[model samples]
Target: MAKQRIGIYPGTFDPITNGHLDIIKRGLRLVDKLVIGVATNPSKDPMFSLSERVAVVERETHDMAKVAGVEIDVMPFDELLMKFAERVGADIIIRGLRAVADFEYEFQMTGMNYQINPNIETVFLMADPRYQTIASRLVKEVARYDGNIEAFVPSMVASEVVKRVNESKV
Candidate 1:
């Protein structure tokens, strides 16, 4: 049988972190093609716009040769995630699980996506221990208090966060 043509990894990626990159890197190894989907959420306020987030992600992964064959795409969707996966021509969906909390939510999503498209499978990758507790919300919270997020996010995004926070104060 031929290998799957494409795999989709979707996330809000408010500020892409090393954890996310880890999954992206690993997921690349398991499929012929990998697409990083930057989901748009209009219901909640996001610190950075979709365009900004896309640029930050693109910059961060620009020099990654391991996944050089992988392509990154930004998506703005208010519909079901399975539809998004199908739209991207992906046969597999990549998800990163940080903890039990994430498992519960991911489990439900996986089932729903399966129902939507049985051919599309959700693959869950465990987050490294070092990043198990890291999340975009926490990163922003720490930055809000003027804490360094250098370790949480990519350098490009870290600088972006600093710029956004500083601009918000004035």
Candidate 2:
């Protein structure tokens, strides 16, 4: 039997978009086990709480996790990404590249992550063309203004985004 290869896909995923799901689905092809690392990004304020973020991912991806043979686990992690990868026994870190700008930023981060943990590798998956322009920041901006977001996120996630945004206004 072949050894199980673990892949870690780390992100804030404030309100995971279909674009993010596209990467997760494609990323599963490279490893036996896919671990979605929901990290706490200190730089940006998230519309959803950590628990809410995790629930949204779980709810949105429940069907995929159930039907896919590749084992899937979504868990929250707070330490350094490389450290989290190491702790989880990840052989590779999966990243999504939507454009050249993403590559430029990920390139630097990849170099640093490699330096921190040379044993692990980073794999970049190009965004599905349909999802290339969809981004969480832009989605949030739209949601805040009561714009339609059904196209970008799962129906459940869209509800959560709207619910959270409306609650904040009250």
Candidate 3:
């Protein structure tokens, strides 16, 4: 039997935004299996906990049959990402590039991951025009100052953001 082509879509996903969803949806078309990895990065302060982020991802993607086939997981890692990909048995790493800035960073990471595992390829997906500028950081920033983030994140996540923001003040 032929091996299944599995791709790992890794991100801190402090909150899964529509842009991230766009990448996952588009990437699923090219691979047999999609593994959405909600990475826990200790270097950054996340607005939501790792478990919370994972639950949100599961909630937002559960009903979509196409995405339901995609496995959702979470990992706390401080080492190279290639290690996580290997653990998940992913032959490809799906990355979403919104602009030149994103490309530069992803390119460097891709090189490092390739060094760790030569068989693992990094595939970059261009952001949909509507989400070209959307990012988790910007989403949090907008919500921090009370700007509407309805269009940036999924409805489930938008509600979480509002709840978190309110709780943080107490």
Count the clashes in each prediction: 0, 0, 0
Quote each prediction's TM-score: 0.92, 0.96, 0.92
Candidate 3 least-lDDT 10 residues:
65-74
Best by TM-score: 2
Per-model lDDT: 0.82, 0.91, 0.82
**What is the full ranking by TM-score, best candidate first?**
2, 3, 1
lDDT of 1 by residue, 1-170 (tens): 98657888888888888899888888777777777788788665789998888887777766663446755554555567787778778888999999999999999888877787999988999998988889998898899899999998888788889889999999
In model 1, where is the ten-residue run with the lowest total lDDT?
65-74
Supply the TM-score for candidate 1: 0.92
lDDT of 2 by residue, 1-170 (tens): 97789999999998899999999988888999999999888687988878888888877777786677788889999999998998889999999999999999999999999899899999999999999999999999999999999999989889988988899899
How far residue 48's Cα lies from its native spot in candidate 2, in Å, is 0.8
Clashes of 3: 0
Tens digit of per-residue lDDT, candidate 3, span 112-160 = 8878889999999999999999989899889888989999998878988
**Whole-model lDDT, model 3:** 0.82
* Superposed Cα deviation of residue 112, candidate 3 (Å): 1.0
Candidate 3 TM-score over all chains jointly: 0.92
